[model samples]
Target: MYAPQDDTTLLVDALADEPLAPGARVLDVCTGTGALALEAARKGGRVTAVDVSWRAVCTARLNARLAGLPVRIVRGNLFAPVAGQSFDLILTNPPYVPAPGAHRMPRGAARAWDAGQDGRLVLDRICREAPALLRPGGVLLMVHSALSGADPTLRLLRAAGLTASVTERRWVAFGPVLREREGWLRERGLLSADDEKEELVVIRAERPV
Candidate 1:
């Protein structure tokens, strides 16, 4: 149940600067509440949003309808719902919290933030596979915590034959989830006693035409 937060705003800001041509296809993976999807639709992009949570799908659908936007909301894992199709842009803000253990990962409400130990559970897969979903000249704009290995994500994207770079970064104070796990994170050397903030990075990877 992730709602709009600083990371969301950062991604939206980055998106606002993109040159989205009219009717450009946009896919929002793990869209929670359709925030990014709606923003893209408002910019004249044909947008589709996918989520693993039934509740999130419902919320996004309702939000789109209420906003009078034609956003297709699908209930499925990342990329599954949009298989066999390509998009001009892909946007996502998946879970990246560094939980204690794999088995200790959150299920219900915390699924939005509790990624396994290294916090790369979902981020790694997105980097590994999302490049294939982009059409030639298309780009992916994904946002996640630097604590979750932002450089690794950039490397992964580059290895996939895409031009990748960190377009933006912001230092935000530890949110509730991060604050709660500060101790464990410190133990893992992912955080420090004086570290009260975490850096969020927006990674942009483009498939060359």
Candidate 2:
């Protein structure tokens, strides 16, 4: 059940409101359905959407064509597809699931959901790499779980040498929680079996000009 979530629209609206400079270069990492990238393109940014899944990349390309926008859809893990290139803005909605062990992700879901044990695998990696890929004065916006929340994410960004902040937030209930080693999680008080829903947090960080 890795459908396009409402966070896509939320991120788009935020970026649009910022009024990105015309012709700015933008990157949308993990661009599942390409909603954010397409929206950025519509707002006058040269958008490039990258996904590790070939299928997702294809879907994004088709969606861009259908919407009559020129979005470059690339297939590679994180920044792999955009090596040697930097952007004025970068956006991502990465998989933030905290799978402690042998967790079974749904077919095709890994491309959209399935972070490492603490749900920070992709997020951490992105933060670590974003600064190098961002131009001076570039911005990065990401949507993740408030379960993991903004604190850890912002810490990682700062550690990566980027100035960061939480730009927006919204409450969303995505049904049951899925994690490997329930007893272990409970023992550590990280999660409980009875927890039915969780929160999502959207954060925006920047590379200094």
Candidate 3:
């Protein structure tokens, strides 16, 4: 099971002050341990959490049960499990770590963090499909590293007909996985040799009313 990391914490912090109507429908994509989903529910929103990893799904369900919060846990990629449903808010902390190999998914725990060569394997899909999952005036709050190109995220959302912008950004030191891959990142011009910190940004996109 994936633990709550800096990216997850950053996403939750961004959701802290977000306004939610009572019983608002909130969808959390790639929910690892249901942390964000639980936070949303605590704010009085009805939450649904989805993840491609069955382990993650199970972990999230258990966490929700232990917390006594009502979060619908589903096992599926992106928005598939919730097709035909629209939400008042959407949240995601997807795999944005650039993998060195072919765009194929990394196996095991790596799957939770490794994206494609450019680290957008799953993030791109979310950026394009999120608007459809949101109701009018609904919002999407997604967190990812700058290594994945924050501007690209914003551009994709805007091109898909949503108003998007970076609402929060925090610089954090590289985690174990990132620290191990630091050399390769620098080789690819993604990170500077002297830079030990990476910027994690919370992107907020809203569907027009």
Candidate 4:
């Protein structure tokens, strides 16, 4: 499982800026360690966290119990388990690293990151679907790598009728996976040979009231 990292921190920090009404319903898609969900619960929000990995769900459940927080944990692809439900806020830190070769969607542990080439495989889907999961005047906060095209995210969210913008950014050094794929990234002209860091961003979108 991908442990919490800079992208996670960026989203958590952005969540703090959101005006979550007391007992606001919150959803955390692709929740890994349930870190964001736990935080929302701590903030007095009713939180639900879902992941494709059963291990992730179990881990998140355990984490919530250990933390003495009430986080509903489910194992399913994004939005499936929460069908017909609306939340005041939605948060995600999905896989956004571009992979080599045919860019087939990843499974297992690799599913935590290995997004297909251009890194929009999951990010694009989230942008298109997440807005529907929000209650009117609700907010969605997503974190992704700059290589995955932040502009497309904003464009998609806005087209979906949400007021969207980048709220936070941070430059973080390449992690192990990125270091291993550095050569292929350069070959694809996505990165330069000397580039050792990547900028992660938090895109926040709000539905019209």
Task: Please report the candidate that would top TM-score against the real structure.
Answer: 3
Q: Is candidate 2 or candidate 4 better by TM-score?
A: 4
TM per prediction = 0.97, 0.87, 0.98, 0.97
lDDT of 3 by residue, 1-209 (tens): 76889998899888997999999999999999999999999999999999988999999999999999999999997899999999999999998999898446589899899998799998899987889989999999999999999999999999999999999999998898898989899999999867989999999999999
Better model by TM-score: candidate 1 vs candidate 3? 3
As for lDDT, the candidate ahead, 3 or 4, is 3
Residue-level error in angstroms, candidate 4, position 195: 1.8
lDDT per residue as tens, model 4, 51-128: 999989988999999999989999998889999999999999998999976436587898889889889888988998
Candidate 4 weakest ten by summed lDDT = 100-109
lDDT of each: 0.92, 0.79, 0.92, 0.91
Residue 63 error, candidate 3, Å:
0.5
TM-score of 4: 0.97
What does candidate 2's lDDT look like per residue over 90-206, in tens digits?
999888766655265434655366676677778888888888999998989898876655798899898878898887877665534443444555675666567655556678888
lDDT of 1 by residue, 128-178 (tens): 889998999999999999999988998999999999999999999888888
Off by over 4 Å in 2: 100-107, 176-188, 191-196
What TM-score does structure 2 among the candidates reach? 0.87
